[model samples]
Structure formats: structure tokens, C-alpha cells
Target chain A: MALFFRLEEAVSDLIHDGDSVAMEGFTHLIPFAAGHEIIRQRLRNLTLIRMTPDLIYDQLIGAGCARKLIFSWGGNPGVGSLHRLRDAVERGWPNPIEIEEHSHAAMANAYAAGASNLPCAVFRGYEGVDLAQLNPNIRTVTCPFTGERLACVPAIRPDVAVIHARRADREGNVLLEGIVGVQKEAVLSAKRSLVTVEEVVDNFGPRSPNAVILPKWTVSAISVVPGGARPSYAHGYYSRDNSFYVKWDEVSKSRESFLEWLRLEVTA
Target chain B: MSYTSSEMMTVAAARALRNDDVCFVGIGLPSAACNVARLTHAPDLTLIYESGTIATRPAILPLSIGDGELCETALTTVSVPEMFRYWLQGGRITLGFLGGAQIDRYGNLNSTVIGDYAKPKVRLPGAGGATEIASQCGRTFVVMQQSARTFVEKLDFLTTLGHGRTGRERRELGIRTAGPQLVVTDLCMLQPEQDTCEFIVTSLHPGVTREQVQQNTGWPVRFADTVAQTAGPTADELAVLRELNERTARAHRSDS
Candidate 1:
């Protein structure tokens, strides 16, 4: 009843070149460590989708693993800015960078729609604007109840979704304490989902049933990696390394420096 | 009676803010208003953010605009399309709260450029979603500390459309959102006239003077015929806001 794979093996097998991949983790917690390793292996032309990306995406792009990036913003707070990605976009680098001008809610909703097998989720949030024109995939659908027009966002089902969690059972049942907004939806919407955990519990009985964010039914692979989000922060386990964030800002000022930093942090 | 400029700006923004409004909050002043609303009057008020979070209810003040805490604590998350199409363009968001590097008399915002579009005196943070949010929101609330440099005669570039070319022209362009409802500064609260989009002082914070405000403005600032005094921040409000900031600092420090 247990499915297990090495972090590197699972990511390499699950994610092929040019695959549409969505990695879970916000600014700090639960980043896809194993996915980053796979990306380091030089898998070319991968398209990444997230609400907002960070150092992981920057490293991928710098390594030539990424072809296109879909997100709103990518940077560390105050320090460690988003110079690599910004320079790439401003310089008209060969990569196709698509900018989503809305809030993170839109990205999560797209996955929710995909998981529920709905064509689109009607949202009455943004009404009369040119935001629709920015992204070719979105359109307007009339609300059935009020007969008012609402935005119909297309489903985003990625080929692979790699997530990091606090704890997991051998069977890949995850327990994500604190914040768990779109974690479930992201897992359910992907064809294959991989979870990296701080610790692998001996049995399912150890974790509170209510705290289990993603059950074994959805996870294809589980790897136990202590001190995940190493450069970043993992709540309750480790604090964020401020030095790294500060260093990122300095490195991000130029592409050459950024690539060198990534090589040290990711490849080394 | 003495308060920091940040506190004055935050209190004014909170008092002027209404319930059930979708606010495109920036970091400092917008964050204060949004959090104060959550603590005081509008607990259920939906916050549609540019970071793609709709109805975000952060337990503490976010470290930055793109803090994962916003998405983690949000009621539901959506894509950029839904944020713009459903909430912003759908005419559901009643108010858009913003701050900027430069603002003009006509209420135009310039967060993208400083000197010129191509070449700039000082390259500011590029227009993230403020441009779209300003143009599309039902109404916008601008909060900034009073300064001549920030309150400019004319913006270097039009990042967000305020009244458009002309006040009447906004309606003709099918801009459903009324645009730039209120501007909250450290010294005063200003509202644009319906016809001209010219700001008139509606209220002055306690101890601030008309001459002081005028001196800080880049152009000849107008004033309402009957201006009122700004409400001061309560002890409880200050405590809550401080607690939020403390927690955020701790979180950042711990993580760092």
C-alpha cells in the first residue's frame, strides 16, 4: 500500500522535458526541493506555473531548464530581488514569459476548476477591464443566477505537481499544519503529485486525521528530506536564512552573478 | 496628539475605508487600512490582491506585498484572470487602495517611470498590478505622506488611468469604475470633484494646516468649502496594529 521513490529519481521520471510543471510552496515554506534537483539535471524547455515563483524558478531559468514562466511576481522581500527574471524579460530573452496581472486567487481557482472537472469557474471579482486581453486563455461567462457577466477562467491541470510538506506517512499521507489554502487543490489537479516531507511517520495513526492535507490516494511518490526549504524557511522546523535572502539581492543585480549563486546553492 | 506620519496615514485610510470593498492594497498604508478593517469594522470585507489572492485574511501584517502568508491565509485563491475579470472588471470591488512613487492633480499614478517612459531620473518599482487595478476598480483610495516630490504637478508616465484624458472622457471610455475616490495623506484627506477630477481637501488631521498641505503639493491644491478634522487612532487600534507589526518582524527574524 506504500509508494516510494528517491527524490531525484521520482522527479526525473515524472517530469519529462517540455512538461508543464507546477511546484507548490510560497515565499518560504514547503518548496519542491526534489523538483529543483530534477531541474538542475538540465531538463530543457519546462513550462512552470505558479501563483508566484521565487529562487527555485530563478535557478531553473538560469540553468536553461525553463522555457516559459507563468506567474504574477517573483522576488524575495525587500532583499534578494527578482533581477534574474526581470532582466530576462526586459532583455527579451528567448524564453516566453507570460505575466498574470491578478491576485494569487486566480491561479488557485484555475487548479480548483481543473480538479472539479469544470470548464471554468465563474468569478464576479474583476468585471470591466482589459485583464482578459492579457491572457488569451480566459473569457467571460454570464452568471446564471444574477444574469450578470463573470470571468470564466480555464482549468490548469499540470503534468506534475511537486510539493513539500511538514510530515508524511510511509504511504504518502501528508500533514500540513499552519497554512493549507491551495495545497489540496494543487495536488488533486495534477496528473502525478510528489511530496517531500520533513519526516516520514511510522504509521498513519500518528497524524491527526483532520491535519492530513493530502491523503495517500492522490500522491504518487513520497520522499523524506529533513531540513527542506534549506535556504528558505520551514515553519516550526527551521528559520529562514536571512543571509541567503540578502545575498540573493546582491547576486540578482546581474545575470552572471545570479547564475554563479545558483550554481553554488542548487548544483553544489 | 503627536503621531508618526505612517500612523496618521493609516488611521485616515481606515476611517475613510468602507465595508464589502475589494481593495488593491499596497504595503504600508493599504496594509494598515486593510488590517484595521479586519480588526474593526469590516471583518468579512474581501481583499482582492494583485498577487492573485482573493479574500485574503492574513493573521498578521504581511512582511511584503508578495508574502506567502497572504495566499496561505486567503479564503480562496484564483488566477490573475479571475482577479481582473471576475472581481476587478465585474464591478464587484467597490474600492481600490493604492500608494505610489508619484501622483498628479488629475489622479494619474506613476509607479513605472520617473523622468520619461524610456529614460527616467529614478527608476522606481515598475507597475506591477497597480495600473490595471487603478483603472478597473470601482474607486481608488490613494495614501501617501504629504510631500511635493510625491504629489507632483504631472506624472512622468501614466501607469494607472485616473480620470482619463478628461473627467467626462472616463465615462465615454466605458470605465465602469468611478476612479480615485479619496487621497489620504499625513496632513489631509482629499476627494476629487465629480466633474474636474481636481482634488479638494475634505478633512485635515489634527494639528495640520492648510498652508503646510499646500506647500507639500506640486500644484495649487484645492480645499472643500467646509473641511473637517481627521479622527485620531484609538489606543486599541494602535495596540492591534503594533502587535501585527511585531509578529511580522519576529516571523521575518526567525526565518532569516
Candidate 2:
């Protein structure tokens, strides 16, 4: 069974220091509020994971909450560089954060493998690419029958997976619609999961054809945080805050402005 | 009215698409080009976004893959795993459109890091779906502004395989699909030499000279024996492109 709590209480109870966490969202439904809550609570030394560690990861990294980042891509999306992420990697201003990079295919497969209780994810990837040279975790395995070579990366079973969804029922079943990323796999692949939703409904209404229904038992805790995935939209709830993304370029460029902005918006 | 070089490049890239082509679209130039194609020549073009929106027909240009317009207008949406495992790796997409920070003679891209991977001067966004898209899509079309800084002789890191290996070597390694077919730049368009798979200038956009193209490239650039000037954007094409831009601006205005 899953328990429901306020966003602050949930973050305090579920996340801890030195935990490997995946705040999974592709470009949509990125649990910004929950991420901010984690920052507010001053969780430290987290190994943060995502396919594209955009604004939220930038915030987490900027706040000195992350020890490492495992991701495929990191950027401000349609703008230019993520300055805070760049600051951490290039200059190590807040703290020296380690990085483990993979391609989108590998990350998706790894998450699936974790969900399936597999040791490693096998895929036809990294062929003639140079990432294999740098990352030791990326190696090759031969198929049993065909004898063809394939790339392999260890399964990503995180300590905690956090996500934002459109809605959840009283029974704790969650509904996700529109451009659903690896949220389901991220939830299942983790030892524990935290879900934030736009609302806690009496019953999940008639869903769209493509909605993902995560039943109660799969989740550990549910937090009803309206506008949780702000800046990154929550599908039916709101549109993506494009203006804010454009503004982030300026605000995140310098340390003073970034820290001030974080202090005012995220921590305050 | 005369069009700018950037607009010419976008129009040319858009005209390259045919109807019903499943284009795995990226952000920036690729997105603009594909959407232009959708609104005009390639109305039936199936736009597959990395965010798992398949056959998306957005009302306006999407700011990013996760733009709400994409999800709201998509024919159907799937999870990220399904998007990669079934659609991309399954080789269902007909084309992949990309933009990159650096590209080598072989068209191998480097969006990862600038000087060194460990100690970097500039840390670029690493490969998202670009690695698989460049490798697995039936073919890829790269759109970038022609400059020595971007069109490099060698990449800092090979993030995606374009024609890094010859056909024989690729066959030996069990890799298939023509990697990058055409690279459309503001100055000229390049096609790989059939034998060497080295990108060579096949056509120059109107008013752009071979000398100008050569001056911008890092390596000694080669040209086709019969290099031709790309036909300027047609009146209808310009009209459509302008309308698309206007609509995008209007869309963003209302959205904000």
C-alpha cells in the first residue's frame, strides 16, 4: 500500500543523504516542486539520474545537493548551455560533481533492465562511438545464439525515483498522459518511489487513450503538489513556461545571480 | 522580397522532405525545417519527437520536445523505452534531422565536450537520442551554419557515427543504413563521396561561392565536378515559410 503526504513531509521521509535518486521526466511533467523541496530540506550527496538533466538537475547541482549525475544530455533546451551545470563540471564552484554519461538508448534500456530485475542492459549501441573509450561501465557482451556483439551497461536501480503525474485516485493509482517518459520504469526500477500529482481525485476520470495507469502497490508515497511540474508542464494542467526557460539563460549564467535567484525562488 | 541565408537554408532543408516521411526531428533548425515541411510540402510527414510524441501535428513550433503543443496534438504518445526500443532501434523512421556543435569530415558529431572529456573548457550537452538516430535512422540530414569552428577536420569526441567507417568495415561490424546522406549548410550542401564517404560540396546555395565555402571549412574542401547553385526558395515556399514564422510568433505570444 502507498501513503499520501504533503510534499515537504514526503521528501523528508523518502529522500536521504548519499542516496542515488532518479528524477525522471523527459521534457514534460518534471517534478520541479519536489526537487525544490529536496533542496529546501538540504538533502546532500545524491547521485542524480535522468535522461536529460535540464533545469531541475541544474538547480540540484547548483544547490550543492548532488554528488554525481548520470544522464544522456544536459542543456537549457532551445536556449544554449546550462551554465550552472557547466559551472559544476568545468569550474566546480558549488562542488565537484562527477558525471556518468550514456546515450538515450542505453539509458532507456538500463532503466528497463532495472525494472526487470536484470543485472545489465544489453543493446546494439556505441558502435564506432568514442564514449566507450572513456566510460568503463560501457562494455560489450556476445549474444548466445547469434554470436553478434552488443554493448552492455549495468542496470540503474536507484535508491529513490521521483516523478510528477497528472492525477491520482483516492486508492493511490496514478495517471500519466501526454509524452510519458521513463517515469513508470524509473518508479519500478528504484527501491522506493515518490510521485507528485496535480491533484488527488476521488476517482481518476475517464482517461485518454494513451494514459499510463500506475496502480497503488507500485508506489511508496504520493504527494499532492499542484503546479508541481511547473516550468516543465504537467500535460493537461498547463503549458510549458517557455518564457521562464528563456529567462533562465540570464539568471543562471553568473554565480551571484544564480545563487540569488535560487535563494529567492527555490530555497525561500 | 529577398530571403536571408539562414532562411534559405531552412527552406532548402524543408524542401528536401517528401510526404509521409517519418522524420525523427531534433530541436532548433531541424524542428523549424520539419515543421515548415509539415505546413507546406509534406503535410503528411510523421514528426516523431524524442519526447515520445509520434506523428505530432503541433499548432505552432514547439520550443522543445516536451512542449505541450506536441503532446496535445500528437496522434499517440508512448513511453521513452517504447520510443527507442521499438520505433528508433527497430529502424522504422525514414530520416533523422540533426544539429551539432562539431562535425568531422566523416559527419561524426560531437555535442559532448570541448577540449577534454575530463577537464573541459566547454561542456556541451551530451548526446540525447542523437547517437541512435544518427546510426539507426534510414538516413540523416544535418543542418548547420558552415564555419571552420563547426565543420572541423576532427571532432573532440565522436558522439554519433556518420561515416566513421567505410561500408566494408561497417558490414564487418554488422552496421547498416546509410548514415548521413546530405549535410545542408547556409553556404553549401554536401554529399558523401560514394567510395570514401567523405562529405563533398555538391551544390552551393545561390550567391554563396565555392571560395567562401572553402574559406570556412577546416579541411581542404572538395566540390563535385558539376557543382550547381541551389534554386532559390520559390514564391510559394517563401509565402509558406513566412506564414509559419508568423504563426509561431503568434502562438508563442498567446502561450505566454
Judged by lDDT, which candidate is best? 2
Error of 1 at A79 (Å): 5.4
Q: Over the full model, what C-alpha lDDT does candidate 2 score relative to the true structure?
A: 0.90
Reference-based lDDT, residue B241, model 2? 77
* lDDT tens per residue, model 1, A1-268: 3567777877777888989888866554547477568757778888887665666676676666777776644555444346656655555343545444333445656777877877666554333333344456667777678776666667878888877787887666787654443556677888988877888877656545455367788888887788766675565677556556666777777767776766776777
Per-residue CA lDDT of model 2 for B155-221, tens digit only, reads 8888888888443445455788788989999998999888888889999998998889988899899
User: What is each predicted model's overall lDDT from 0 to 1?
Assistant: 0.69, 0.90
DockQ of each: 0.20, 0.79
| Interface RMSD score of candidate 1 | 5.9
Pairs of residues clashing in candidate 2: none
Q: Report the number of the highest-TM-score candidate.
A: 2
